[model samples]
Target: MDDRLSGYPDPDFSLGTLARMGSSRLVTKAHSLLVTDARVWPAPDERLGDTVSILIVDGVIEQIGAGLQAPDDVPRLSAEGRVVTAGFWNCHVHFTGREWSSAATAPAESLQHALDDMLLSHGFTTVLDLSSNPRTTFALMRRIATGELRGPEILTAATGLTPWRGMPFYVKADVPWVLRWLMPAPATSIGARLTVAAQIRGGAKLTKLFTGSYVRPDQVKPMRLPVARAAVAAAHRRGSRVFAHPSNRPGTEVAVEAGVDALAHVPDETEGTETLLRQAAERGIRLVPTLHMFASTVTTDDGYLAPIRAALGGFIRAGGRVLFGTDVGYMADRETRGEYEAMRASGMSTADILRSLTTEPAEFLGRADTGSVAVGNRGDLTVLQTRDDPSPADLANIQATIRAGRAIFLRDSPSKHTADAP
Candidate 1:
């Protein structure tokens, strides 16, 4: 097997090879850039123009309009009639395994390849790791922030909280010892609250709870109500949003009653699921429809997918805020096309799907400056090679991914150029 393809370093490799291949340039330095001839969508609901030019300076959008000009020193990238939208956010992801946790210290070639294949290639500039080792994940985040690593802006929930004896059967049997150490089971309400405080103090920006834990294929154990309540209250007091993994209907109820800000998935479609979804929406509980995760786990039959689709459709119809997340690191399928198709099958409009990827998640994360292509916003853009009025699936046609005015991942094409004269 090819060592590079296997994500292992070659003994014959050296810094010269890394420099010659330009892996060092994978993370572009923040500088001025001019993007021209782009079909710009300022926001999911707002199309700016059919053809537009944007001026980016010092990692922020300085101007956006037609025929924009910049200094001679500023580089120009032509969109070539492609669609440019704000960068996408994957709200459900993980940084598990040795490859991810050691990203900061990994070889440049391996780390850059991993980032491109796992995250940037999918146009995700920001990601929320639902569950991961806080110390390692945060170290990776710091490396990215310092431009030592080429990756997305990451928000980690640190170690996730579960009830005593609540570890999922699959995880207990399949997950490695390193990952298992990250998930802690707090047996009591006091333990739950204390765990929440400790995680937050350890630099967790968000909190996650396994309100419903699947101990077996036929059995799910729900967290105690008082414990759930205490965890939520503690996280809220620390100004961190709490996300719940509701494995079933009973788990969804516990999460709702405990006031979790988001449901990590659309709960199992049982009787009264619609009512539960409606209540969740009324209570302002957002949902991350990890529909594709479910599809990947079960047999691809109507009998299996129908209920999940119906539940997602009902949640959408009830005006629930949906976030796009593919459970990438944990599930091992980084491609997002399946998730997009599943969401489209659930009757989500292209606009709704785009909002879930961009605007809604940005707002959910309290990042008013991102998720839009406008002057003064962070110059995080996803350029897609698609025709006018592209469908949701067209999102897979990524041409380049720009974060903070730097081209992190650009698809190779003979005609593609990072800089062109206007």
Candidate 2:
């Protein structure tokens, strides 16, 4: 293993080793035992696996597959009939925390806590906080890493880059003024790019930009291609990926041309052309549909989402990468709420939805060691209460959230069991 990635202890230092180290207190087990017969998704070939035991040891997956006896000293959880998968990732999010007036400028500490609570409660083990003042964002992330806060893994950009006047105003009250603050002056964008470089210098895993116009969704004034290119190039040079927010066809085209690693959202009202999607596929770019947020807000009145949905379906059919995400601002009641709904509404299959929420986004975020329930992945699992077709209400039914190998969210609600089970 490369020295940089060598920090994790040897796998042999498994649960048994930790117990011997007097650190057994750090290890925990799943709350309720689930002994499911088998769980498969995405037609089973897209990295889904067969029956697995999925032992959790110190927040990491210690072992997988059946018949591995839990040590007599350790507690056992038999989750028969309950499917286990990696926690979800919301790749596109805005951190305004929970306050109404000071949300945009909320203290990073407060926002990180609330955001962590929301994501963990919703079963998202990882989140790429798309837009934030990168300095503060990284500080919060540092806190999470140091156990100063409790939350999912946070990946963030220093500040989103866009022309000084065209940024979106998502925060409540005086949002327009906040736009003025977020817009990229040549100096500001340069400073922001430097901030991004600093983040890379300081160990940021990714970067973000508002490459396309946010002024008016339809009247797309794409960011200057050279400027867009520069931001992405600089980030890429630093071993950090860049994500762009583009909300129109022209803007999407610009993002693709600029070679941004990911798009925070595809064009609204305008469905992507096959050519565009194909080009994006060829470039190995990723798309965060943020379908739920769009479905709930922007596409609500005009019915503009049908084409977006169809476009996304085409993209999926074309084997383009898609990640699950919801654009959330603090204090919003429905933050991170519409992923499953939008997937169902868009006619995505259960398997596809599961992959989008799990493996797909995890892979995109460069977290190959997470997302799947496997031998060495992080033991972050979300166990829903049922195997039946979930209703909209089921969105709230996260029976348990296992972080690392420990149960973090265990629901006391009744479960309606499915027929196909252990």
The digit string of per-residue lDDT tens for model 1 on 89-177 reads 99999776446635545676766787889899889988998876554565566667667666787777876787787887866664544
Worst 10 residues of 2 by lDDT: 1-10
lDDT of 2 at 180: 49
Residue 46 deviation, candidate 1, in Å?
Answer: 2.0
- lDDT, candidate 1, equals 0.78
Q: Please give the clash total of every predicted structure, in order.
A: 0, 16
Candidate 2 off by > 4 Å: 1-52, 71-80, 99-117, 170-184, 187-195, 216-219, 271-274, 330-337, 388-396, 413-422
User: Which candidate achieves the best lDDT against the true structure?
Assistant: 1
Span of 10 residues, lowest total lDDT, candidate 1:
1-10
Question: After TM-score superposition, what is the CA distance of residue 265 in candidate 2 from its true location, in Å?
Answer: 1.2
Maximum-TM-score candidate = 1
